[model samples]
Target: MAGAGEPGREGSGQEPLLVFRTMMRRLRAECPWKREQTHRSLSRYLLEEAHETLEAVDALAAAEDAGDPRRRDAAASHLREELGDLLLQVYFHAAVAEEHGDFDLDDVASGLAEKMVRRNPHVFGPDPVAHDDATSVDDAWQRIKAEERPRAALLDGVPATLPALLLADKALDRLARAGRPVEDLDPDDLGDRLLGLVAEARAAGADPEQALRDAVRRRV
Candidate 1:
């Protein structure tokens, strides 16, 4: 006999997730502010949480590089908390969608699982190919992703809202992957010069975004 609040009641031993899901559902039902939120209203929070999570990750990495065990441990805990906050944004969005009859959290998770399985044929598909390195696996993943969107226009998937340096980096990378050549831009134009710098960073195996952030941090 299944009892209320039993672990078995939550499928597959995901009791914590189920409990949080229930909490979100209840919040949406009972909280006046939560009840009034639309997807548009919640969008800013999702971006803020994502950036907070990234900051947490950078803190952890910095702590590790400094070889401070105590700082690393604290940073690790902070990162975990930030990750949970980011995850709550997902649940919040899913809750909103569930109310609108769009989709539930389970549908969102299932779609992500299906996409991962489809993209990593070297691991999930039959007769798995032995990838020589991470680069090979990544190449295969990118190739499969491109193949899936055969009719998509060039630059179709790149989000325009990305930071200028990162946006230029991704655009150049996408063109390179597609075997398309970009025409040289006017050297005198500041924006074009910055784009050229992004291309240089890529050729040098550096992240232009991280490099710029680090430069600013050093100056500060």
Candidate 2:
């Protein structure tokens, strides 16, 4: 009694969505190893796939620089494949969540949608953003975020697990968003400070994070 719309059929059944469900079912049924996976076990695979995707993006940029049409096309295909791998990781994670009865892909999607709507009041609601200085827009966004989270510490939102360079960038961005007077520091002085810190890190064989954290702790 298989219908056209059914999986492997023509009509009269629920249309088989070739999406997360199909992938999940295939993983659960056909893939014995995929069925045995837990979130903790799959974390490394997810990170590896993400890094591969980043590599593909970097390759695409390099191909663009060379102006090779064939390389560019190949890079694009690689990028798409890498992205699909990343999407699979997302679905795999969602499947794990579904097993736990916590939340699934729909919840993840809905939560992101809600967060986007909440954050982008200008885009989604009546209060459209006015044309202003970049600093002003950033300040307004931070203010909105602060109102939403109401964190005790200013650095609460920055992910601690981010790479050191990215973490430092986020920290600086947060400070800038809060209207800190970085303009007061001379460009030469800033350059010198950064160079001196790099030299010190090289000399001491110390992590820049440790040095930066110590300095922040002393000041704060």
Q: Considering every candidate listed, which one attains the maximal lDDT?
A: 1
What local lDDT score does residue 22 receive in model 2, on the 0 to 100 scale?
65
Estimate the TM-score for candidate 2. 0.70
Give the Cα lDDT of each candidate: 0.87, 0.72
Q: What is the C-alpha lDDT profile of model 2 across 1-220, one tens digit per residue?
A: 6564444453224443344466575666667899899999999999999889977986787798789999999999999999989988888888888888989888998998998787776778687876467656666667787898987776797778887545655565566557762444444787646645544564465657545654664576
Clashing pairs in 2: 3-11, 4-10, 4-11, 5-10, 5-11
Clashes of 2: 5
Model 1 segments beyond 4 Å from truth?
1-14
Among all candidates shown, the one with the greatest TM-score: 1
Q: What is the C-alpha local distance difference test score of candidate 2?
A: 0.72
- Score every model by TM-score: 0.89, 0.70
Tens digit per residue, CA lDDT, model 1, 68-112:
999999999999999999999999999999999999999999999
